[model samples]
Target chain A: MNKQLLWLPFAAFIILGLILYSGIGKDPTKLDSRLIGKAIPAFSKSLLLSDQTITEKDIKGPALINVFASWCPACYSEHPYLMELSAKEKVVIYGLNYKDDKQDALKFIDRLGNPYNMIIFDNNGRLGIDLGVYGAPETFVVDKSNTIVYRHVGEVNERVWTNIILPKMLGTEGQ
Target chain B: MKKLLVTFFILLVILPQTAFSVISVYQFDDPAKEARFNQLVNELRCPKCQNNNLADSNSELSIDLKDIIYEKVQAGESDEQILVYLKDRYGDFISYNPPVKPSTWLLWYGPFVFLLIGGFFLYRFQSSHRQDTQDQQNDEQQANSMLEQWAKEAKDQETK
Candidate 1:
């Protein structure tokens, strides 16, 4: 019985080693969104296209909010996929231009075809703080109620759309 | 000697330029508010730069957040209210001090549990070790007494 007890520490050490091993390749930056199942944060800001002020009330959902910056390299990397989703798949995408120069952002859109249905310029990042946005190249899927259902950080490619964003946005149609 | 002088000159010029850090210049009317602003930023973690606090990170988001926090501190908002507001948006992960929840229960209590388990094993080992020593000593005493009894019997038989 006492000899068996000697193996207990070794068993515990092995269990701990196995538990820590599972964390090896996981991305630390992928944080779970607290905004999920909640209505979009209230904001009143100006639209990029028009002089009129826009607010949370102006947003209709079952759409995608793609946060991007002209300076972020990943935003450019995901632009082609975003364009495909918008132009071909007919996904309604709202652009949240995060803390970027307006002129450079406009030039980027002009250069690579605007994939956004409407652009909300957040130069001061007031809305971004309210939304808990970490950085650019993050996407949020809002349902018809304007409730954020899913959020994907990094880039939105074909796999991400098919697996997470699409099913989250339209339920059965994604499958 | 000329090459050494040129290298020294380059280091003097470039090192100083590289050492120049961009710091937040938001001026506060009250010294208390300024202190609070400093404390708040230092406590809040920068989301974009995962390892850095808002005070240390130069990321644009961190700068904007520091500005927002400065404004709030200046507006006479308490530290608790500001933290709550941030927690609501950024989740508990934003704070260096995570709250006690089901998920975080292990993190908060794991060390204590590990210590307890170690103490338990130590206690068990020590007691079992003591028992083994006592048992061996008792066996030796019994063997010694038996040998003495046998010697007495032999002497008694010779005397008879």
Candidate 2:
């Protein structure tokens, strides 16, 4: 019995080691959204490329609301993928221009080609705060009913679209 | 040499203290509101920085969060309301003091449970050790008495 008891600490150490090992190489910055399955928060903000205003109602249908900024380098990196998605018409994509200078944002859109159907200008990141956005480029998938189904913190790439997002949208559609 | 040492100490400590005191300044209508803002920021975690709280982090996200906290404070929102608003967006991890819930039970109780289990094991081991020593002493005493008895018996036999 004493010999068996001696193994308890070893067992505990192994269990803790396994737990800590599982967390290794995982992105610590990616936080799960508390707003998943909830409706988008109410807000009306001006369009970045147009004179029109974009609101929560505009977020309806199977769509992607990507938070981006002219100042964020990651947004530039993900711009081409967004353009490809836009060209394919797989889903409607809206943009939330987070805390970017208007002239810089306009120049960025002109230089990189606009992928957003309607871009919402969040000058002070008020709406970004409402959406729980910490940094760009964060992406959200809203279902037809305007409910946010998935939120990705980093840049949306092909891997994320095919593996994480497409299946989620398909599963939602099947339901 | 002493004067030089004092000057070096002042340069290393006092001068750096003023230089590194880059705490962001914000205008508050009332001192109480400023105090509340300070407390709230310190209690909230910076989502971007991960390691630092809002007050200690100089990240852009932390600055934005601090600004939001200030706005809410200025608007006369209660601390609880501000926390709720942030938690709604950032999840429960944003708050340093997470709420007591089923998911957070392990976080709140794991250390105490570990300590309790450790203490129990320590107590059991010590008691068993003490019992083993007592048994060894008893055995020694019995052997010594047995040897003495044998010696007494031998002496009696020789006397007879």
Candidate 3:
């Protein structure tokens, strides 16, 4: 009994060490959105390129709202994948220009071909706060019913589109 | 020289407090609202910085959250409503004090449970240790009495 008791602390320590070890090197920044399965927040913002205002009602059918900025390097990295997805895939992509200068954002879209169908200018990040966007390059997969199905916090690449986004979109359709 | 040292110590301690007060510059109509804003910011976790609270973090996201909190406070929203708004958007991760739910019950009670178990084991170990010492002392006393009795019997035999 004493020998078993002596091993108890060591067992607990080993279990704790294993748990901590498993968490090592894992990305802590990728937070799960609470907005999943919830309706997209209501917001009225203007298009980035034009003066036309867009609202939550404008976001109909299955679509992708990609939060991007001229200042965000990760957005640039994901831009090519977005362009490819827009051209090939049937996914409708909207851009939310998060807290960026208008001229700089326009220049960025000009330099890198605009893949977004309707880009919303969220100058004060009012929409962003509602979307719970902490950083740039976060993508949300909104279904036909306007309910947000999936949210990816980092740069969305081809692999992410194929694996995570596409699966969720398919799952949403089946439902 | 002693007076100069004391003055220098006072300056060293007090000057930084004034300088650090620059971070909180938003004015409030009501002092109670201002206090609530301060408390909310301190309690809310900065989504960008991760480790720092909104009050301590100077990140852009933290600033935006602070602004939101200020707006809510000015709008006469209760502290609970404001927190719920944030949690609805950012999830429970935004608040430093998470709500007690089934999933978070372990986090809330795990340490206390461990402490109780540890205390029980420690008490048992100490009592057993004390009993061992007492038993050894009793054996020593018995041996000492037996030695005395043997010596007395030897003396009696010698006398006879």
Candidate 4:
């Protein structure tokens, strides 16, 4: 019985170690990767588009979802990439405006030049949290099946286009 | 009436002294210093909580750290000195943006390494366990069939 009691504590310690090990070092963005190759999460939000109300359903198609916030400096840095992406009709690029004041986001768009087919406002970051986003300027590529195929955290730069997207276009992954 | 007057006098005198002492410790004035302090607090980590920064943290340690910063700044310490002192005391965990260095390679890369090692072990362990279980089940099935065959031969001999 004493030996059993000793083993009890050892078992508990192993469980604790396993729990910590499993949780440690996981990037919140990796959740996006898990969502990749799976159907995109439901998108239902209202955002300002060309002085009119726009909803996610209004833009019904496979889209590249980019989450951005006006207050995030990183979003400003990635504006050029968004512009280049939006210019392309190969994939519809939609924006999830994450946790920003409406007026400030509008001002940011005006200065940066709007580069979204439609913008969906996630005012309180509820949707962002659900998507396991740590911070702003994350990009996701959805295939024709509406499955999220790619997720890029932080800034999406020239290297991302060269390394990530071009290969997808050519029907291959960089591995 | 005399007792009441004496009590009132004692209360007023003691309370004001205590309040004055408390306020003197946390003088939240000087707009410039206040703004810089706020910015630093927001950038500092609570250490106790995963998601909370010092500015937003309500932990007692965080509050004490803030007060320490306030005291040092009021004593005319430079912002850099305060940052250095805090970093020295708490290690890089004090800062939200921990500096990347050779010493900090573990802090930065530890998680990815852990994940990779864990995944490798999990894959190996599961596959080995699966193979072992398959072998055990096959052995059990074979034993059961052999026992049944022996029982059938004994019954046939009894019938003859």
Restricting to chain A, the TM-score for each candidate equals: 0.93, 0.94, 0.95, 0.71
What DockQ values do the models have?
0.54, 0.68, 0.73, 0.02
For model 1, which pairs clash?
none
The residue-by-residue lDDT of candidate 3 on A40-73, one tens digit each, is 8988989988899989999875889999999999
lDDT at B134, model 1: 100
Model 2 chain A: lowest-lDDT 10 consecutive positions: A53-62
Q: What is the lDDT ranking, best to worst?
A: 3, 2, 1, 4
**lDDT, candidate 2, A55-143, per-residue tens:** 89877668889999999999999999999998985578989999999999999999999888889999988899899999899999888
Q: Is candidate 1 or candidate 3 better by DockQ?
A: 3
Tens digits of per-residue lDDT for model 1, A1-175: 3677778779989998998999999999888888988999999988776777888988888889999989999999899999999989998999999888889888889898899988999988889888889878889988888888888998999998898787787772343
Choose 1 or 3, whichever is better by lDDT.
3
Q: Which model, 2 or 3, shows the larger lDDT?
A: 3
Query: What local distance difference test score does each model get?
Result: 0.87, 0.89, 0.91, 0.72
RMSD of each: 6.0, 2.7, 1.8, 21.9
Q: How does residue B104 of candidate 1 score in lDDT?
A: 91
Model 3 alpha-carbon drift over 4 Å, by segment: A21-26
Stretches > 4 Å off in candidate 1: A21-25, A172-175, B1-26, B139-160
| Candidate 4 DockQ, CA atoms | 0.02
Q: Model 4, which residues run further than 4 Å from truth?
A: A1-32, A50-61, A88-91, A169-175, B1-160
The regions of model 2 sitting more than 4 angstroms off are: A21-25, B1-24, B153-160
> For candidate 4, lDDT tens digit of each residue in B15-40?
97797465443556687877677778
